[model samples]
Target: MNARTGPLSDVRILDLTQALAGPFCTMLLADLGADVIKVEPPGGDMSRTMGPHPNDRAGTDYGGYFASVNRNKRSVVLDIKTDGGREAIFKLAATADAVVENAKTGVMDRAGIGYDRLRKIKPSLVYAAIRGFGDPRTGRSPYADWPAYDIVAQSMGGLVSITGPAGSDGFRAGPGVGDIYPGTLAALGVVSAIHAARRTGHGQFLDVAMYDAILTLCENIVYTYSRAGVVRGPQGNGTPVLCPFDVFRSRDGAVAIAAPGENHWAILCNAIGRPELIADDRCRNNPKRVANAEFVREAVSAWTTAHTTQEIVAAIGGRVPVGPVNTAKDIFADPHPRARGMLIEVDQPGDNPPLTIAGCPIKFTETPSGIYARAPLLGEHTEQILAEAGITDASKEKS
Candidate 1:
């Protein structure tokens, strides 16, 4: 294992999570130097089979989906339903600072390894859960028993209601923000609870609901409805409150431009060779420009459509806020990601070439965080982990 060196180096986390949301939360902790032990079932994580595998590594144990989020962790297989498995978990929990999982409400409790059971062995163990709704221990929801995924959370949480073009049903975001955001919140909760446990000699149970996370992401709509009694729908790429704050067609591609502030608006007008519009009543202030958004959009579009994205950026890049729409290819070619160490290259299983995954965004000067190791194979460290925890008979459950 790579030498752990970061803010969380001293923390030990028992990661009983699979799939994106739970894994994502633990990934953050692992990246920050936490000793995250990923406890997998007999069949391994379902995402192990969810792939975009390297063409040459068809028999690889996991694919991009699993590797991306499970990096920097050790894997140990255990059948928690068995008495030996349950004993192994209890032993691990006795030394763990936290335990994280994303199963449905009662799944862990039914298996006899839930927070209530583990807290008895280690009272200072922080137990964090991520569920579609929320755990009943915190608050019960009518849909607590219902299963949910990213799309379901987005739709029910109001995100899909305010996305995409106006006049049509909104679109789901391309990425799984529903799972990711909840996972992020759960990670935060685990860390905070661990800190409290250290000081107070007590641990607690916490949970993050995917639905609640998406609702928080779309917080603007709630205040809008409550304050103005306005049910805001999708405004497309441009918002209703800002003028000239939208993507415009450039000669080669599209570029986003925001000029809601007076100075920025003036700078934008000058860059587009339309300085006279700065003093025009219809476009002078932000509100007036928003009221005449169509005209303003057309004027900005007319100028943008004539210039290449690069040219437009060069004209007002520093003076105003602007960025060209970047695709995966563009991002790979960009220097920023490379300079900031956002793209990480890691070895793949088999004889395949190394692959690049996203790097940790969190940066600390004294103790830097990074991808020190690749994702572990299923049960890769089962023997080592079990031995370290003094678990002997649990090895019989591994298949």
Candidate 2:
């Protein structure tokens, strides 16, 4: 019944990241039951102060942003700038399965705790890094030293170029996929490297660049530009290739309708009481329908606009792919998330009421993963973690 009993139960990771990318990667590892020891500098991760703090919990521990991404892990503060701190991290790294960081290219190297240095202590240590551009260990980029955030990656990696309304100047995505995607890829790289290390007893330096990861996420653009000589632009709610795969208006709110396949198309036509559109030459196949997108869009819009979102769902919920565009309130009220264990309620100290955070999406029947503990207060587990690492007298180290 222990929460920290999963696939990565025996693995240990030294997390030396601040802000989004690195913390997110290690957070995933922690979620999988890895002993992720978050190594924060003296002042702690910059994200600790990035607020959206609950009104009742003002000036109490870390803010929501830090809490959200850093659950199920231990925190230990160390001044990597100091000789004592450097010695402590190397000692911890020697006993760790992997080390993860997301600072700019040479930040860790400048601190004397880079991949090369850690590998010297534990030859089989998986040193994973998430960077804005990339590390030279894995093909350096010209912009390796440049600092970047979500917006920069989205714009530079071709995502923003094809986002937003079709005629608009494109917009950055609401969520920070620029950071999140790279973090996800970094987690994969770390795990993969760990897998390889377990077999070969040799670990290597691996990195996921925000720019590269986003480009990979936008694979369609790469293939289209290469094969079809088309540079895609902002597509709004629908793609140029899918005919009825667009968000449409409803009486109360919006609903997304995707009936691209012939069978689904026929079902949608029937649901909308327009079965004749199925035989219409311009709307026959996917290609023709895509060419006549405006007509298809208008037809679907006509039906959706006449009905409420609930009515639309009732008509074609299972017959074709259709869903109401949900708001925060909608998600909280919906039963699907609750039924699937997607909404996990956790207590936020100092905040009178508990807060619900999204649960782990990766489920396993035999080795399940989940949120076990809330995020730590700054260096909350410092002495305990050091004791576990056999550093009984950690008083000399900053915490």
lDDT of all the models against the reference? 0.92, 0.89
Each candidate's clash count? 0, 0
**Model 2, stretches more than 4 Å misplaced?**
56-59, 394-399
For lDDT, the strongest prediction is: 1
Give me the overall lDDT of model 2.
0.89
After superposition, the stretches of candidate 1 with alpha carbons farther than 4 Å from their true spots are 393-399
- Give candidates' CA RMSD values in order: 1.3, 1.6
Clashing pairs in 1: none
* Per-residue lDDT of candidate 1, residues 118-163 (tens digit): 9999999999999999999999999999999999999999989999
Error of 2 at 378 (Å): 0.4
